[model samples]
Target: MPLPLYLLAVAVFAMGTSEFMLAGLLPDIAADLGVTVGSAGLLTSAFAAGMVVGAPLMAGLARNRPGRSSLAAFLLVFLAAHVLGAVTGSFPVLVASRVVAALSNAGFLAVALTTAVPLVPADRRGRALAVLLSGTTAAMVAGVPAGAALGTILGWRATFWAVVVLCLPAVVGILGGIPAQPAPRGPAGGPALRTELAQLRRVRLVLVMLLGALVNAATFGGLTFLAPVVTGTAGLDQWWVPAVLVIFGVGSFAGVSIAGRLSDRRPGLVLAVGGPALLIGWLALAVLAGEPVALLVLVFVQGLLSFALGGTLITRVLYEAAGAPTMAGSYATAALNVGAVVGPLIAAATLGVVAGHRGPLWAGAALVAVALLVALPCRQVFASRSGVPTGPAR
Candidate 1:
């Protein structure tokens, strides 16, 4: 609720837009570069790979420092990457710029969540994280739409330029808006990073984080291939694809907002309902490919239910980690990156090997089922600790 938090959200919004806008612009980038769209799609893969490596690398380097200034520096790095991406002439150079952007992107988010955790009271940690994570959803709702429109009119590179332009004022906002806060000191006696990593080794915590990863994989595995799935299989108009995605984005934002409220009361119940609903949504798409309206409805439902699990899993992991919030946040960011990478690879193998788009939907359903099993154990953990603390991870 603080001004600083809002500024942080704006930066996240920009980053989210830049990261996701590539999905809609793949064709444009491919056409301009004279490459296959699938090859151009490596921009997303490159970004995810960077995040997988960057989250820990950047967070570890920034550890034990005042995170505010470090976060600002990372944002500057993110801004520069986008600017270079806009101007780069060669495809490989553009890909490299995206990788740079991804590193900054992952680092910025990990740092932001670490800074954000201690900003509010302990009782509100789940809500705070939900608020922070909402920026990603808001990016889908607002940034993706805006970027897609810009790319359509001015070219894909122009959208990257637009993100670069936004980052300048965002930097100004960060300087003027956010309050200076020191890094978190460890509880009682300080623990070394090795101790912190050891604390996170608890099986329950690891399971919850892996569950989060699987849920993310399922959602994105199907989603990354969504536009093509609808156009090629559902026989929908190409121009209408972005509109469908916008609807899904709206659903995602709505789910994220609702999940925050639900986590406070019945985290387990939310997952129970959401997990099954997600399975149903995917099934509807697999069976109803010819019905575009039906498919879009399923997409909306899928987004709504798939993301409903996010807050619950994040809350559970932070709670389970107990004494390593920054490390936990860093690792949580890493788990998410793992999911992001897995989603695309899973989709690619299924669709590519099978030579059909339906593979992603089927594979996504199976992934969700695995998440569902993981959720059962999560429910038992929460149920047994009905009056447990839901404080920040540390």
Candidate 2:
């Protein structure tokens, strides 16, 4: 990858770490904030809500702004949010900080996503996207686990401070790497804001994005309370949490890495194979919740299957949103965060009703089952159903 692309990845790494590290810190956050673990998990939803709204809103606001300036501005806001979050003792203040951080993260991601595409050839767009999103995968592999350790050794506040520090490199990278000029206007020399928002009305586009959301819902639902699952349900010690997370992250990185090679060429087949496999993995996880060894192994398997399916869904979403170049990344980002919002919310509710950590496992399985059904008319399904034209929606 080019140095500029790596620069973008560095920014993405910071954003992803800020977004996903919460999964590991929920317990500590809850204890410190005088809230339930489920309540602490709401911080994830808070961040997702900001991303859901901020991606498009901030992208639109910055559409005519210089890429380098807008990116730098976003990073500054992100850094400030983390500082405030780290210093505050109020849970509400922390929640508010998460929203602000998410807004910045969302804006940074939108610009980076659009900018990264133009830096690569048309045929290699998928590979380029993979490189950018690999920051996310790398966050899972390195950042989240490291943050968990920091929180464990110091406190959750230290993790927040760590994020503030981690973002410094991104700020410097954006300033030095992205070109200092506003995005070029459309071919007709007109802003495409109207055209961009109109793409939301396209049923095919919405449904494809829905597929992306449901898959994400499944992943985040299980992920939000994963620390508790590791220590509580699986009977593992608290210290084992980070190691288990590392195992899952290693699998997640590998899964997405493999998807990079396969998804662009055979998204349908990737979905066809990955969807069912992930669902089965979820079921096995719920059923095997009592076995510490099984839980550890299943977490790895689940991470692999989930991200492989997720990458394919995201690639398909971008394909469907091709008409909205400036907004394509926002739509994809929204789809992922939509899942993040709904997943933990529903999974948290399940915690009250279900017997143990199995609730999220069940919820994840059901969500993906719906995704599979929603995508029934997609390539392999319709082809299997006989003599139907190919499509990605119901």
Candidate 3:
């Protein structure tokens, strides 16, 4: 609802593009740097690893810093990493750049979410967060594809340069738009890492984090192998892959928009509905992959439930960890990345035993079923805490 939130979204867009564009540029980077394509693919893994490790580390490091200052610093470092990668053209340097960029990206996101939530009314935090996260969905829909096309035309280095350029406006926005908000303080009147860690230990918070991981694992496990499923199972032409992806992206955007509006008042309801909805979607995909029309429709529904569940889960975590906003946000990022890494491994293993393209779908469905079981008990947690809703102190 505020201008600063949009700026935060811009920051996420740049970071997300950097995270995903590597997928399209790996072949080019491998050829140019004289490395194997598989080696270049490691850059993506390195970025994910950085996000998983760096988020909590950076959050702790910046725990005492003002939100605006820390966010600006993170973006500057992110921009510098891209510039170095673009100019150096060395494979090792490029790999290092991705790690640095991912670290900074994690820091920016954790800080930005912490920053944005306090800027709005308590009831509006869900919408504010949704608006901020929509930037990533936008990146998936537009930024990655555009970067890929740009890499194809002007070379992959140029795409890095473009990311650098895209980051500049966000930096300026952080400086000019966001007011200085001091880091959150404990009851003792200073930032307390111990207190935050204690809050993180709560069973409610732990369950929420695990729930987030399961949701992501379910979605990405299948999504990672989407292209093959589209062609091999659905009997679609190669050209249909991108179109189907676009459809899924559109569904994701719609999901976020709907979930954002409802999460503030009915987060539990959203989760209850979305989690089961996702289970059904995955099960449908497992059975319907051979039917092209059914497969396409289910893919779109899966994307919708994936992101809708994601937003609701984040809202739940933020609520449950209301005592430690910064660390809570970092924990959320770490949980999601854990799923991102583990999901594909699970899918790959399932494919080894399962006979066809449906393995991923079956794997995803099983994960979602587990997530639903985990989610069922959470209603009591929310009920116990309902009297004192956790939100920013105005």
Candidate 4:
């Protein structure tokens, strides 16, 4: 991998840390702010909601600009938001900072993909993409857990402060490491947003994107708040929370690698397999919650499969939307944010009615079913174009 790609990865690492660290610190933030845990959770939702709104809007704004400059600028915006978040005293102000961070976060990922694609050869696109995106999983594994630990020891506010401290070095690293590659200019500059939106009308392509989003969102929606669910219902020790999260991160890391390799050859197979694997994992977790050993083993396996869909699905969407790849990435990002918002809300709601954390597992299973149904239409659509059945992309 090139130095530039690694710099991009650092930016991604920062985004991942900033985005996910909130969940681990939710309890702390709630207590300090003198609010309910639910209110603090809105911080997570606000960020996701920002991503949902920001991805397309920011990507569209940069349509005519150079991908390199846009990516760099977004990182600057992201850094500033974190700085504000750390310093802000009021809760509403903190949410406002999150919204700003959200815009930067969504824009960074969307543009990063767009920026990265042009740097590599066509046949090597999948591998290059895998390398760029791996940073996200790495953050899940390393950044979030570390932040959680920091919050536990120091203070939740200090965690945000720590993230802000990371940004200074990150900004410098990105500027130093990334080369001056000129922005890509299409034959007529860039296509109009209207033209890009029209590409969605291709029934098969749009369907696949939606299916990918549904699957991606369905898994994350529940999984994001798994810590709270487990802590509340399972009656686990507080120290165990970080350990459980670290286990999930380990699964995520392994899943990204496996998913990347498989997607390069067999995207459809990975997606098909991932959905069932995740469903089973959730089911196992629900049934075995009482048995500490069984629950841990099941959740680990579930975590591996739960996120296995990310790389494969992203590649699938990229290939399907080759006509307008950046827009496709944006659309996918929007689905991701939509899922982020919907997942926790669903889990919270399910818990409200049901007595145990089982509600989330059942809810996730239902979502996986929806993802599969959505994928059915998409499979037929992609089959005709690629002249490949529901096997591997290779």
Instruction: Tell me, by lDDT, which candidate is best.
Output: 2
Best by TM-score: 2
What TM-score, over all chains together, does every model reach? 0.92, 0.94, 0.86, 0.91
**Which runs of model 4 end up more than 4 angstroms from their true locations?**
185-187, 381-394
lDDT of each: 0.75, 0.82, 0.78, 0.71
Give the backbone clash total of model 4. 1
Please list the residue runs of candidate 1 whose C-alpha ends up more than 4 Å from where it truly belongs after superposition: 183-190, 353-355, 384-394
Error of 4 at 146 (Å): 0.9
Q: Rank the candidates by TM-score, best first.
A: 2, 1, 4, 3
lDDT of 2 at 79: 94
TM-score of 2: 0.94
The C-alpha local distance difference test score for the whole of candidate 2 amounts to 0.82
Give the poorly placed runs of model 2, Cα more than 4 Å off.
186-191, 380-394
Give the alpha carbon lDDT tens digit for every residue of 1-394 in model 1: 6566678888888888887777678778889988876677677778888988898788777776666677889899998888888887789998899889888888888778767766766556567777776777887777777787778778888898888887888788877777765554444324566776796668787887888889888877777777677778888766666777787778888887777777656777777788888877777777776688888888888878877776677766666765665566677777777887887778777867664878888888888888787667556765532233322321
lDDT, candidate 2, 1-394, per-residue tens: 6677889888888888889999889999999889999899899999999998899988888777667888899999999999999999999999999999989888888877777766765545567777888888888888988999999999989988888888998899878876676455444533378987898998777877888899999999998889888888888888888887788888888778767777667676778788899999999999997799898899899888888888766666666666677777788888888998999998998998845678988999999999999888755421221111111110
Ranked by lDDT, top first: 2, 3, 1, 4
On a 0 to 100 scale, what is the lDDT of residue 165 in model 2?
89
Error of 4 at 350 (Å): 1.5
Give the clash total for candidate 3: 0
